[model samples]
Target: MYTTLLENIPMLFNDPTRDFVAGIIDAEGNLQILKKGSIRLVVVNTNVTILSAVRRVLADIGIEIAIRPYGKPKGNERQRYRVVIYGRGNVEKVLKVIPLQHPKFFSIPLFSSPSWGRKSGNERDPRPQLLPPPPGGGHIGGTAAV
Candidate 1:
């Protein structure tokens, strides 16, 4: 079943090129909206082949990305390769292509950019909502401070 799927994966998307790029981001990727209203799309995996494929696809489509090592993962840990894309232009490129749909369908509107966000206010709010999600209100891993 896996082999058959692998063989047919390439055919899954062509016209909707964003779907293909999104597949990578969804699989081992993180699309984050930072505090400064910038987009941080991170794709990490042990498989170099797929990472390279992502690079090729994004490059051909004019969204540039840099493939980098995913940092030292402690002793005896498997190192992963990563492809990261930043900034509004790049995120805009992606959002324009596919509307940032897929991965997990959440409350973010299709017309709205999944990566678009507002910068943090310099002055501390007198009363800020404690339980509210992050600026973009999306899935974020690791420790985050409010």
Candidate 2:
């Protein structure tokens, strides 16, 4: 809602003592509030060579990503990766390294799921999932380097 000029004329002040009063009036008139929801971001087909750089960038930009390093075969050209990012605000600035047009890199919004228990939105932290059983007779998420 906007106020008319005549109705606002009483708010205009020239005396130094009225500065504080004018400020309060302006602040009260201009006050705005926001309503928001959580969002879950998932990074698919990311490049592992830039993982550390990407992590720093995300942290600096106030977004958190769960890092799950997938292994590469011997003599592979570049390390392929899958990272999950979760947040509520715009994160495209932090994801500048990703090629927005290419299919090899993309981000998706992961919605909250009641089945996941403790529903997950863009705000929830991500954990590694669907990893293959380790060789040498062990389970995943152990002390294995990617």
Candidate 3:
């Protein structure tokens, strides 16, 4: 549905389009904490057109992003591109404009916290403390290397 719409016409920054982009993010996006403790939102797809449309929608909301080739394509596979929202401020901006309904939703507060990557001691903390697991002791998400 999104591919068809995105390929046919440009997307507006209206509420419906925002929700549509949110759905795309929820399905294809990853909210990640890089090794340096910076946060990013990434959506990967084989279709550059769709990713470009997504980028336009995000730009309308005053958030900047970059579309880059992800990696080498496997045999018989299309090259993947990533629409990335880098840095704490951009990630926060996306969260404010789009309500994400996914486990990634829990990452917003943690990513927005001022002390997210700060060291509490004299030594540089190798692994910043993340939010504790949920009440039932389930995993939240994984961190990505830089």
lDDT of 1 by residue, 29-145 (tens): 655655544455677887776777777778877877878887787888788888877764675465456444544433434223333433475543322122222565444433132
Give the winner by TM-score: 1 or 3.
3
Candidate closer to the true structure by TM-score (higher is better), 1 or 2:
1
> Could you give the C-alpha RMSD of every candidate to the true structure, in order shown?
9.6, 20.7, 9.2
| Best prediction by TM-score | 3
Number of the top candidate by lDDT? Answer: 3
Name the Cα RMSD for model 2: 20.7
lDDT, candidate 3, 1-146, per-residue tens: 98887764643432336767887788888776654456677888887777776787888888877889999989999998888788666776786678778876564455324344556666453333444322433312343445
Local distance difference test values of all predictions, in order: 0.58, 0.35, 0.67
* lDDT of model number 3: 0.67
- The stretch of ten residues in a row with the least summed lDDT in candidate 3 is 132-141
Ranking by lDDT: 3, 1, 2
Task: Give candidate 1's TM-score.
Answer: 0.59
